[model samples]
Target: MSKRKKAPSGNPANRGLSFVDRRIARDFERWLAASDTPLSDPHNAAGAVGHLFDITKRSGLDILEPSDTADIADMLLDIGPNATGMVDLFHDYVHFRLETSRDPRWHQAHDELEDVLDDDTGISAMLEAIITDAETRDPAVIADALAHTKVIDGVTKLLDWISTSRPITDTGALRLSDIEPAAAALGLRAAGARTLPATGDLHGQTAIADGITYVQSMWHLEPLAAWWRALLDTDVLELTASRVRPGRASQRWRTEPTPPLDVASEVVALVVSDTVLGDLPRPLRLGCFTLPGARHTCARGPHPRRRRQARTPHRDRRTIRPPCRTRLADARRSRPGRTDPQPPRHPIRRSRGLARRLCYRPARGPR
Candidate 1:
């Protein structure tokens, strides 16, 4: 096959075109100027708002940020309110504008207000129209839309105001009434306020205590242990508890590697014996109790006594016999050294004997 050729890499003949077609850019600049005037006109405000909304949406730029808001506001000013019909359109636009200002970014709000107020008509009429519209629109839809339009400047100003009051412990405690005007000025709705705790009320304390008790309950223990086991087995968590800090309790615990097989087996046995068996009533305990078997003659399909007999291990054991006479032979040979080489010792037998003697094993020699 023929080799493919690489394209030229240096600046091309169309470099300027690549940078944003100067003519189209200028056209957009002019349109922006024209939009300000049209936006002020009641008849033209909707279309301008729609266009600005679309532009900002498509740009993926946050219009709430100071830099973006300032840039957009400057562009709007350049377009000038005179170009659009009715100076009132500008007022409407300003009144419906959402607060996009964030903390410490007063520049955008200052610049935008300055630019708009500089116009002879001012923005009050637009505000009145917006307030009227808000009264008529669905509150839920308005709330959602207002949430999206939050201006950083409005939030910052409200926070600052709340800070001065000392009545609110935190900005989070401020009510809608406290910030509604700021929100309105930014063309947004104020959300409802939350109630504060009354003095001497211990609701938060009670909740914490209840949560701790719920966490400590035995029913939650196994699940919690399993969760911790899974975490450790996955190698994301270390077994050492020292790594955790008091204030960082909210941090997720990491997973560790799977535990040794013997440990897992022991855990399973403990869960079955200590947890399950210990939970049963004494008379119904496994291996110690006999349960009934099915009795076809009974209306309930089984007599309790028969069912108990079926479950009883002693009854089952009576029906089975040892595989060979090895045990008898071992018993005979075990009596005083008959010395016909004793039948090979079973590993299980050796294990049982070793286990019985384990308590007597000597301590290891000093290292």
Candidate 2:
């Protein structure tokens, strides 16, 4: 994970939760910028007074955190006809423009995504499709993918340990001697070979390949223990009480080296993602961005309204270490009443996870 560059602009304590705040704040701005709603118009100014106040109240509500899938769906549905548009802006801002500045590291994983945002004006359709699926998606899908990832992680470690000792018994089954150390690696508990029941409901479900049973490892027992049992139940090891290595997928997984945590997380997310969702490869990736707490100019921390109001191009003010740009826009040409040339009104139609894409302007010479 990227280290917090300069201590997030929010409370140090609040940094943990600031990912949601920062994401919501920027989402709100991007939505307003891309929508048909003309924030720059004088007539809309009459309504802006009430919506801005509502934005303040809503932001104070910790962004109306949804408890379940239904709550999010309701919030988004209401935004469509509520007429004020603040609810919609705040409620669903997944379609957003990417900032001009980005860390080089993220480019490796998201290079194609960045290209899509920068060049694909059609991204708005994709963004809408994502939202449709996201509303129906379990908000905790990321957590679920991580849980699966742990299994992959724990199992890989256990298998490596097994290879060194070859803990196989005379009967050709392996023993669980010294298994606790493997379990400890994953922060999970292991048994003394006789702790768990000899057979689970799928006692005979082992996959026998070339006379060697290859048991399938599905969701069970944290991550490590379930995998340990896969080996034991398949007779790779003597089926003892405590088993289940977290990372290994099945008997075949042993033949191949385990993927890096990032790769593993992405693969697992894809396995769980629906086509409509486009892709689920990056809860861990997004976490990588937010977990470190994105840096912004305001040291007191980022507020959605404050985030929205800061429209000027900050130049070098909040250039995050490793290059995470905090400025939502390069507002030099975006400020009102300036008769300078402007990019398309809604240059890059995007939002929330849709962060990426700004006006593709030519390189400028230093003024």
Candidate 3:
């Protein structure tokens, strides 16, 4: 699939000298002044802000208030209802302004003052949407969520390993197994660890290397771009990208200091979020809720929506949590393992459920 669709915003340089427009232009100038993308580039913030501003002017409103995110429904009605490239330009510009611009005036190429979205929901919703989109599995949405969990495991394991030790390969190239399967490998993390990079190659994920199923598997089973974007958002991870793979120009991620708590999100990719997940398959958003531990005994229960809870309640809090370290020898050595069998690992981040599943191990990251 094409990674993302970006629209062209009209000429920000052509904005009027009216007080509201000038204030917006000034904000765009300051925001663009600090941007990494040069002003000359069409993709840059200042270059495209004016395109949609013109649309707002045509609407007779000081600002452009989009009725829908994926498709600017209101704008399309004003023009024609066709999904033209020009419409795409407007859509892309909205997200571009929202993500790249520093101020709200520049966010939608408009003049009306509106507060930015609730930070927590905006961040978490974007995350869930991406992971759901990234999934390409045949089984169900749960499979995709499971695979994302594995990626988190892989990342956490790699961070713990590389920071405390040196790279296994002399040239600083870490293998795939080193990073994936991080949850299961915790027992072996101190003993034998696999340090794989974020791979763009799907075939390589399951292709055997060094006698393990790519150490931890399933991350590459989804769209490679999503996997790359998912973990890159956290500020804790400082990935030094390497191109050391034999055939592919894949990333060779190495360890940074163990991530400290409290990094929210990043916008490296122009993600196809900010829209309601109505564009995606229903299974991705609506899911089954089974008994926490009893897979064999229990039948698939009604999902969160069926229970009449608020929609997408999980996204309400987008907090970043650091991985907690367990000192088994000092604290739990005297205690014995429980006689009851351990429960299955929860795929997505259900902290309490995952705790029961990954009993006595580190938690999955800021899910």
Candidate 4:
């Protein structure tokens, strides 16, 4: 039998990227240079935005923090339609141009190069450049510059796409096909955005963008939990909450190890809600309630009455007896002079009686 040849590990730094990959990277670099966004340095802006996208996607929320929402809303309002075009164009280049290139391996090489450019070393120069620019720029210069630019509006739309339960289409935009995947991922019933009319008092382009914005915002703000609570104190999100695992859309359950039974009992699965989950510690934020069967897990803490009962301990004669003691007490009641112990029907109960004789037998004075 011949051993199969292993594929070589590809790296841009060691092996050097293909000419096509380098060209694509340079194109991306030029795009970043031409932009004037909130974060003057494109690397930092991309990093921050990418982090926000991931968190938003995982938690299924539009606004992670309420205080930041106003600032974000204002930023988006400032970044007009032109900025939105820039974003769409960039996504087109990344998703389509590289993938459709003549060289079969060009797509894989381009993806690898992009990943490297996102690293700390790749971004270090950009960070230093920001510092140099800051000497002449105003205090909190990035935030100030961003506040004035229309960049946020476009970026927010991109984020809206990322945060949605929908999967990104081949074109990097959400499609109707993505609805089911999105629903499964975020535990939301996905719906298509309402179609916009052809023309309006505003330019057709502006009107369409505004309509998209409105529809996306409307569905995102209204969580299933909030909708349910409005109708009743409790509501069912799904029938199989226990069987539902993390990364459902991605089929992560098939590979990821199921937590032990004891650990599973302690696990608290995260739900999609309006509340800020980003504020939680990482572990707890990801934990989902493993409610077996058709049970609906309560979000609220323990009941006040239960808390009081737990704190106060009392012994009840009928219920509190140990197996051995209960058997002895029964035997004493049943016959006047019978002191011999009766063997318990079950092996476990019999073992307990034998253990009782060993531990608590009347002490035969120094015997």
Among these predictions, the greatest lDDT belongs to 2
**Per-residue accuracy of model 4 over 157-275 as CA lDDT, tens digit each:** 32234342333333222344443333333344444444534543222212233333212222232332222211111111111212211222212212323322221221212222112
Off by over 4 Å in 4: 1-177, 184-189, 194-252, 255-268, 272-298, 301-367
After the best TM-score superposition of candidate 2, give how far the Cα of residue 28 lies from its true spot, in angstroms: 19
lDDT of 2 at 99: 34
Query: Candidate 1: minimum summed lDDT over ten consecutive residues — where?
Result: 289-298
Residues 24-80 of candidate 2: C-alpha lDDT, one tens digit per residue: 444445545555665534334334423433333332222222211122222222222
Candidate 2, residue 239: how far the Cα is off, in Å: 22
* Candidate 1 structure, TM-score to reference: 0.16
The runs of at least 3 residues in candidate 3 whose Cα sits more than 4 Å from the true structure, single-residue gaps closed, are: 1-157, 164-174, 183-219, 223-231, 241-261, 264-367
| TM-score rank order | 3, 2, 4, 1
In candidate 1, position 54 carries an lDDT of 38
Q: Rank the candidates by lDDT, best first.
A: 2, 3, 4, 1
Cα-based lDDT at residue 238, candidate 3: 30
